[model samples]
Target: MTILNSQHILKNLQELKSFWQDFLPHLNDRCILLMSGDVGAGKTTSVQMIAGELGMRDVQSPSFAIHLRYENAEGKAMDHLDLYRLKDDDDLESSGFWDLFAQKNSLIIIEWANRLDFDYLPLNWQRIEVRFEKLSDTERKITTRQV
Candidate 1:
């Protein structure tokens, strides 16, 4: 079931931060954020802002590494994953993507999520899909909907 649907046109970093600050509170403790966008569409930037809000520092894209894990002082785990290089289920299996579902109190943020097959996701998981569209050099239109 859908729980939230919204869109924001952010012209600068400050506006993006403001949007995240207002939207973060509505998320569940254990949720999966599936993000889709072209290169430089602000997908990773949005994750960084959200991590900063959660007291995480130096959040970086895991494009080459595939995945990075962060834990807040409160013991909340955030898994950042980049699936841009992964081509199929075999890659996902090798990357241990399914194992993340066993973790508790986790917020999983996946970039290039359109590469993932949603049918394989556990039924109990709360998934929020976010799409980022670059409007110009400094502007992005981010749309989100829960599924």
Candidate 2:
């Protein structure tokens, strides 16, 4: 299902939280989530809520560090990666991007993922696309696959 706004994504997260187990029965290790969206499209905000659902405390975006690795008290590490600067940083592929896929209990969320080459991304990964309507603050849409 494709949610048409930030609030819609929030609602869907809550709705899907309880039923998450059903969605991924054998889910284990190194999950990848590619979240594509324009600036201020709630990409970071959605990740924060997912972290909250996973019992992660104090979620923060690593847009500056290029990547963030945060593990809550539960030892579940969520890597929030910002590809916003990747357009210029051509050496990112060799700088530990591939290393993250080898980790267990790691969930990576790549914002502005469209900039990266598809070959660098994992196959069969979950994808989400966010679009804005016109040029307004409240105009946005989020579409997901294999959620």
Q: Whose TM-score is greatest here?
A: 1
Error of 1 at 35 (Å): 0.3
> Residue 24 deviation, candidate 1, in Å?
0.9
What is the number of residue pairs that collide in model 1?
A: 0
RMSD in Å for model 2: 5.1
| C-alpha lDDT of residue 7 in model 2 | 26
lDDT by residue for model 1 (1-147), tens? 222587878999899998889888888877999999999999998999999999998899898888899988988789999999987778788888899999766899999999987778876878889999999999999899976
lDDT value, residue 66 of candidate 2: 76
Which pairs in model 1 have colliding backbones? none
State the lDDT at 87 in candidate 2. Answer: 53
Compose the digit string of candidate 2's lDDT tens values, residues 10-41: 33444444333333333346566667777776
Tell me how far the alpha carbon of residue 68 in candidate 1 is from the true structure, in angstroms, after superposition: 0.7
Clashes found in each candidate (C-alpha, N, C closer than 3 A): 0, 0
| Weakest lDDT window of 10 consecutive positions for candidate 1 | 1-10
